[model samples]
Target chain A: MSRQAFSWGRLPAPEQRLIKLASRFDALPTTTESLLPYGLGRSYGDSCLNSGGVLVGTRGLDRYIAFDRDSGVIEVEAGVSLGEIIELTLPQGWFPAALPGTRFVTVGGAIANDVHGKNHHRAGSFGHHLLGFELLRSDGQALHCSPTANAELFAATIGGLGLTGLIRRASLQLQRVPGPWISGSSERFGSLAEFFALSAEAETASAYTVAWIDSSATGANTGRGIFIRGNHAEGPNSTATPKGIRLPITPPQSLINPLTLAAFNALYYWRPAAVARDALWHWQPFFHPLDAVQEWNRIYGPRGFYQYQCVVPMQDAETVIGEMLQRIAESRLGSFLVVLKTFGSMAARGMMSFPRPGATLAIDFPNRGAPTLALLDALDALTMAADGAVYPAKDARMSPTAFRQYFPQWQAFARHVDPRFSSSFWRRVTETEVT
Target chain B: MRRILIMGATSAIAEATAREFAALGDALFLVGRNPDRLTAIADDLRLRGAAQAETWVMDARELNAYPALLDEATQRLGGLDTALIAHGTLTDQIAAQASSEMMLAEFQTNALSHMVLCTELGNRFEAQGHGCIAVISSVAGDRGRQSNYVYGSAKAAVTAFTSGLRQRLHPKGVHVLTIKPGFVDTPMTAAFKKGPLWATPATVAKAIVKAVQRGKPVLYTPWFWWPIMQIIKNVPEAIFRKLKL
Candidate 1:
């Protein structure tokens, strides 16, 4: 069977192999061969892909074991999706402390990536809310790991990219909210300095804050975009469900060229809604706007797209980001969707977690073959020079040297990875053959 | 809010459909083979706005337990306004061809067990005289191909049985819907290569829910499957026999 990432890139036709469903943790297969725990396949890059190995699809194991309404604590199978969690918890005035851009991502994927959301400035990454989890190993041993119990393994497993073992079930602390609606405001910022100023102000006022930069802009208008800041609203949620629009097929590659992107970026920046100062928003629209369009990635065409995300230290954030944006503008290859955000002082629990007290930028580039790869390489160099790290969850082509520079603790984390488990990303970054 | 009973509630399609009902604030009585899984699903439903989400554990293959299970579901949910049966195994076609035991086991799990539960639920729904009973049949049942005739034949039995049940229950205002889904991308079909033809479990669940509400006797999920299966069902046996599909 062929498995592809959400980006629709790296479609490897792996030989179909079955890993029998384990109704209980005790029934998990005991095997020495490399295995990857597969969930909803929502990962954009190679982290979820195992080229020559077995993938144990975990969606069947989805179940919620326990939930305490009073304390807002919940235990769920790793296969459960954030969408399912939201549907199950939102009515109870609780939500996942940390969420990704999409609700389709599974709990296991969130932990493996240590995903951060709009609230990273306040809530940190997904690993911060993880209470404990049960890891089933190839030797048929189910180890319980938490901050206090088997803490090392717990740290390694959080952003271990499913290389540690199969996460069967996990307990997490959810954040209690007033309701599902977000009382928010959006303001247009003219330059990078203004963005920094607005983001600083948002930190104290809003629980969730993020900005969308028009990467295509340059010179005096560089970094011109909309900054959205929000907090949970105290009222009954508006019951209107947004009708999803689907991209029926992959369009021609020429459909999303430089001209189209520039126009789209300009139109989006000057939109009336983007200029609006305040409005009430639903959780879905505020947290996962792109989700309203099903298979929206198809707009990038069949070759798919690449998301380049990197974080640099707070001190060097402005200069590094400005240089990167200048390069993108000179190349005339800027993407339509560009996001910039700042991380809070709260530390991430995962050893390899991507979030830190710094500024992060993410941009999506349609796969235009060599030019796209070359531009990304230049961006990587800039990030590395600023003592920054690229997010592995969104990477497909980071060189081993760059990976080592980005995550210096890889060698130590390698010891904790299960010998019986490996992934394409792990192999690519480590340059090691599957055992 | 409706009172609902979902047998095999842990199955992907059933779980998704249960979420739809839960969102509507329905009372649910969930029954599944795994007690832990059932309890977990119940907990999720409770949090999703289900007025009351209760669970019971019973292996569907145990036909003798069908009556008691139905009784418990009815008693727990107070009354059943809707019930869904969404469980079946996709057997290894090559293995089933070589072993009679494999074929019989597949039949027992897919057709016989469902028939037993359906019969028990039919009687109760008939007495109540106002409810919906939706069962998931497969597009493979439209016409049996050599690739999966063992699984297809069992689904064929279900389609035929549900057709008769629909006729019998229609006059009494009890609805029976047979859901025929084509190439759903579920854990059951995870091993198969998915393509444009594949649909998500949530998509199929939405169709099933809509079909039940509209009192449709038969439905092809995703709607396109109706025409696709029509073409497949019309294929000459001479041509179909030579094709590997």
Candidate 2:
């Protein structure tokens, strides 16, 4: 069967021939069309998408292959989502060493993107906890990849954007935690400099740390936001995590206009915060706030939105971020959702991993066509000038020159990409640039 | 503990339904044709909070083995209060028409096996004084259409058997749920193009779990199928014969 595949950002994807794979042994179709192993469409951009080719949907391979509660080690089909793993292991007092903001992403998606979470200051990206995976190639070889085995492919496939081949199954080292509860706290920072100082303090105090920036604030309050941090709580938790309610219907048009965006950002930052100062949070709320409202992405409506996330060097983060925020505040085209966090000195295991020693900033801009695209371009220019890289998983329209500049190792990573596998993002950057 | 026995435990809907039961902290004794698949499912169920999971390797069509399977499951789990039969083939109508052997084989798998299991379980549950049996029948059984009457006829038989069994066991405090699911997206129907009418295994499983809990005797999964089936079933034969349906 064939269907049009759209991404999480509601960007229209190209028509794709659909192939359903149930088992690890399922053969890739011998057709000449390119094939990409597509898990949940959780990625915000074209990285998880294929155009005029086949998308091997991995939904059927979702299974826990092996688990050791005692050792906190799990072997799972790459198709298994993080949410499923948590459901299975959390009761046994184990959790993924690293987790993205949303739990909907499959383990394969996490590996393919090398997703970073709030714990980037401590646990690093998802690649660090990955033990190994079985890579099924078009040539019919199932190679076991890890730091020791098929090491190059291991590095390439992690953050490889599903271009290398299909990751059938993977083993991960999970961290042991007390329960499904987080000991958390938050305090507002007055300025961009204060945020940098406070995030450093929060990182030292807690395992998980991230901040919400008020991009609408200007001048003295340029990067003012909330610095929130948490660690797994000790002892029992009486409060139960409420089941997240889904956005049942998509609105006719984008609800996040400039008026609403500015209002939301102001209220989010300054409203006499109701959440307790030293609250014990359910891990669900502490980690996956947006996931709770399933399909909240559709609220951006048919035109969709673009998520711009980039990591600049920690050396000049404040100046770079301040300039970017000032530009956004001046333009009045900012959004409600803005996040800032820092990455530790630990390098990502992926050869093309996006996370580095940097202070990262992410914002969502509702697609206003050329205007939004131009804004995204300006943000990219600032990031590149500061020698930072835009996260491909979060980008829809990054320029080829910018991509090459951002990921200088793209040439090396290109050598390892499977001959028969490619993605829209890969083609957009390389094909257009080369041609 | 919720002790449940799942026959054809590796089928998509069965596995999805087993997941629901596991989340309820059920102790499961899973029966399936493949050892590797069953072991994988058992372990997954254990991780999903099934208090304990045991597996037996045998196809559900092996009717003779079912009694021993039941006894083994009852002995292993201490008791069994719930059983879901969610195994069948959507036999290729063209292939079945060409071979009586293929047609009978499909009947044996889709009908006779389910009927025998129901009879065995009905006796056991009636003797125990309480239990719930959920057998997945198809909406195609309501009125046999030309395209899939072979498979539909078998489901019709199973549905009739389940209905009679439900009446027989109701006085004895047993719940027999005959599931009439419309098109479901499973490996069984992977080749067919899906439309708005299709329901996911999880959706069907959830409705089955709800009906089983409420002791409902009949269920048209997704609820909307109930009216659609009613319209189809009420189509008079005189006019139905003129149409290609």
Candidate 3:
């Protein structure tokens, strides 16, 4: 059942041999091509795509191994999505320690990408909450990976970008919450400086904090957007799962342009609860909002898109963000879905996990070929000059040198990558020279 | 207030269908070959709000143990409202063609085992005079094609057997449902390339639960399968035998 495998952003849809593994215990689907474990295809870039190889689709391995309601420790097959975990555990007053913006991501994808969520400032990356996992190599060796045992392999698999081997099953340490509701708040920031100020203040007060910058804003309005923060609701309780409406079709061309971006930003910045001094929000909207539109990526049309996320040091964050915004404004090619957040000062559990102590900015742009590539490279230069790093999970075309710079342990990590497994991203970054 | 028994409980479709019943607070007794998977599923069902989630490990093709297995599951759960027989394999047609042992073994697993379970459950339900028996057949059974006639013929036997069972049980206050799922994306069919016609296990499981609840005798899951199978069933042999399906 081989077909063209497309990532979430629909960029670089590669012709892949899709071998679905129904049970974790079963033998790997025999293939002459290199293999990469694929769960949910939630990675936004070529990191999940294996061109001229086999994509072992692990979604069919969705199963629960063990769960202890009292201890809040749950073990599940790698293919199980974070959304399903919440559904099974929330009623018991438990939830994953960290989750990305989308709940559709699989547990294995979360681990491999080392995804961080709104509470990253408090909880750290997903790999930090991992208890252990079974790493199935192509040669039929199931290695138990954790901090205390096979520590190097554990670090390599986390943010390893599916290179180490196939993650069969993983046990996660779930965090206990009061209930499913969140006490949220919102405010407007006038500039990049003001946004940082709000972030510092909310650091100790709120468990979850993130901001949206109007990417189209320039000069006097640079970085002016809405600041949002939330904490688990201790008083009110509501446990309703949000219903989703799908984007049924892909349009002929991009629906996002300068005009639409401006309009959407203005309306979204002043959206309902823009000044809700006190708001009790359901977990879904408070966490995963864009998921309401099931295939929202189709709005970018046939060419697909790229999500460029970079992190700069906290000391020089304001200046760098302002410069980046000014450059983006000059190009007049940015969307309204810009995310700004600050990472906590915590040592990474995985060697290549993206989050570090810094201010991170994520911007989206529809693929316009050479222009988009040039703009992204220019931005990468700015980030590298400021001793910053670009997130590999969100990148499709970051230079190989930059990847080596961002993840200094790449050479060491390369020593552990399963010989039988590789990805388009791996080849693009390492130039396919593993030795 | 239903006590459900799931055979081949580890199948993706059976697991999803059991989740629906578990969410409704029904008691479920699951039977499967893999003891570890069965235990895990039972535990999952309990956490999903099932009043009682129990497990029995038995290979579905172990025909000699059918009566004892049914008796134990019923005794453990007090009674049974529905019995869902959903265990089968998608044996490679080419391999089956090469080995007679493989072909008959597949028949034992896909058809004969189901007939025995249905007969035993049928007797229990008839005596109780109120129960539902739903077995997952396939639309491939509607007409055998050269590509998968062995698997198709086995399913055809199950479909025909359940059709008669439906009529026989109707007068005894029992309901027999024959489910024909077309191109489901289960492990049994994982090797096949999925297309617009393929349905997810959850989708097929949803229809099965709804049909049993409504006491329907025959169901072509996804509803559209009914029309599609109708057209295939009527394709004249003169043209059908010549064309590869």
Candidate 4:
């Protein structure tokens, strides 16, 4: 099987050697060389890729172990996806405590990435909700890790990018929701300052908040976009399931060039009905709009695109984000979707988790070869200067220096990484051989 | 809601189909060789809105276990309205050619075991005078290829057996469906390079659900496989023998 990243970015193809983990615990302990747990390949970067190494495919290990309806606690095997969880628990008045941009990601992947969402300002990242998990080491030892048990290992493995060991099963504290419907409000902001002000107010008023900036805008128009905040609505609303529309095939390279992106962005930002709209949305459309269009990434054309997501401290957010947007506009290689959000003051639980009390911005740029690389490198420099870090889950080509700089605890985290397990992203950023 | 029984519930195709049934609030008795996987599938089904999801673990290759398993599923599900047999293995043709035991094991698992289960289920369904029996055959069985003839031959036997079973059950008002799916992107075929002709397990699952509901006698999932298989089946052996598939 040809395994590709979600971004569809070009990278060194990994040797596709996969061992399907059985659902039975007694059936496991299958010995393999340099094994990495491969979930649903939803990560945008090569964090899930192990070039020339073995991958223990966890998709087969999907099983629900236990659920407490009263307490809203559920225990499930690592392979179960967030979408599966929502499908099962939403009707019971429970939902995942935290969710990423897409529900297609697996439990193990969510933990490994410590993924955040629109509600990061309220609930924090995925790791914050994990009550406990079982980590099966390469040496055949199964360690029960949590805040109180194997605390250091728990911290290391949370955002360890699957390098610590194979995550077998995890127990999570599911959030209680009134219903699956979201009462959402969207406000068009004139500039970056306006977005910050809206985000501050929404952070307290709503459970979820995020902004979509038109990255193509330059000078005074830079950071001009829409801010959306939403809260779970009470009672039953119409259960309008999203009808998936798939991109049948990859289009030609000209499909997502600057001209098309600019027009789309402008039309999206200035749409009359979207200027200050308040609407009721099903959870699917509100949280996973991209999922409604299956294989939407193919719209970026055959070459694929790269997602650059970074977070800078609240103090330097304005200058750093402003400079980053200015650089992107100058390059004329603007993204189709550029999101900006604010993280709360909640301390990160995972040692290497990306979320911090700061401003995070994410943008997608079509892979335009050397020029694109150069532009991204410039943005990385800005992020580094702001004393911020790029998310490893979304990075394909961050330099070793930048990685070391961003994650100052790399050496400490590296110590906990299973010697037998490694990934393309780990290899690239660490510049080390698995042996 | 329909009461359904899925054999080899852990198989990717069967799992996907079970999910669809669960989403429709069907009652299910899932049977699979792996206890952990069976439990998992059942739990997922229950969560997905299945009225009741029960599981039984027994190796389908052990033909003697068929009777008891069927009894348990029927008893648990309160009488099955539909049953799907989707247990099979794709063996290495080259290895099987060198080893008679390998070929026999493949044949037993893919064809003989299924035939046994179908016979047991067919009798009950016929006696009940209403039900559906759906078995997953393969497009590979349409014609033998030198590369995987051992697996192909087993599927061929299954296709022929189901046809006879369908004929026998029709008068009794028991519907029998033979599903000849083209190359599906399942774990069984994960090693093979995929192309446009390939379909996902979900796609095949949808076809299976539709076919069972409509009481279709034969189905080629993705529909396009009907013509593609026809073209291959019609090839002259004289020329086909010279070319490698």
Task: Write down the TM-score of every candidate.
Answer: 0.87, 0.93, 0.95, 0.91
Model 2, position A379, has a per-residue lDDT of: 87
Would candidate 3 be rated incorrect, acceptable, medium or high by CAPRI criteria?
medium
Between prediction 2 and prediction 3, which has the larger DockQ? 2
Chain B TM-score, all predictions listed: 0.97, 0.98, 0.98, 0.97
How does candidate 1 fare on TM-score?
Answer: 0.87
Q: For candidate 3, lDDT tens digit of each residue in A340-413? A: 99999877798888899899999899888899889999999999988899988898998888887888788899
> Best by TM-score, which number?
3
CAPRI grade of model 1: acceptable
Winner on DockQ between 1 and 2 is 2
**Model 3 chain B, poorest ten-residue lDDT window?**
B185-194
Task: Arrange candidates, best DockQ first.
Answer: 2, 3, 4, 1
Off by over 4 Å in 4: A1-33, A254-264, A432-435, B1-3, B99-102
Candidate 3: clashing pairs of residues: none
Model 2 lDDT tens row, A29-148: 778899988888988888878888888888788988899979999999889999989988888899999999899989999999999899989999999999999999889888999999
Residue A221, candidate 3: how far off, in angstroms? 0.9
Candidate 4: true interface contacts recovered? 0.48
Predicted structure 4: lDDT: 0.86
Give residue A367's error in model 2 in angstroms: 0.8
Better candidate by DockQ, 1 or 3:
3
lDDT of 2 by residue, B1-245 (tens): 77899988988899999988888998999988778788888887887779999999888778798899999999999999999998788889999988999999999999999999998999999999999999999999999888988999999999999999999999999999999998889888888898889999999999988999998999999899999988988898999988787
* Residue B12 accuracy (lDDT) in model 3: 89
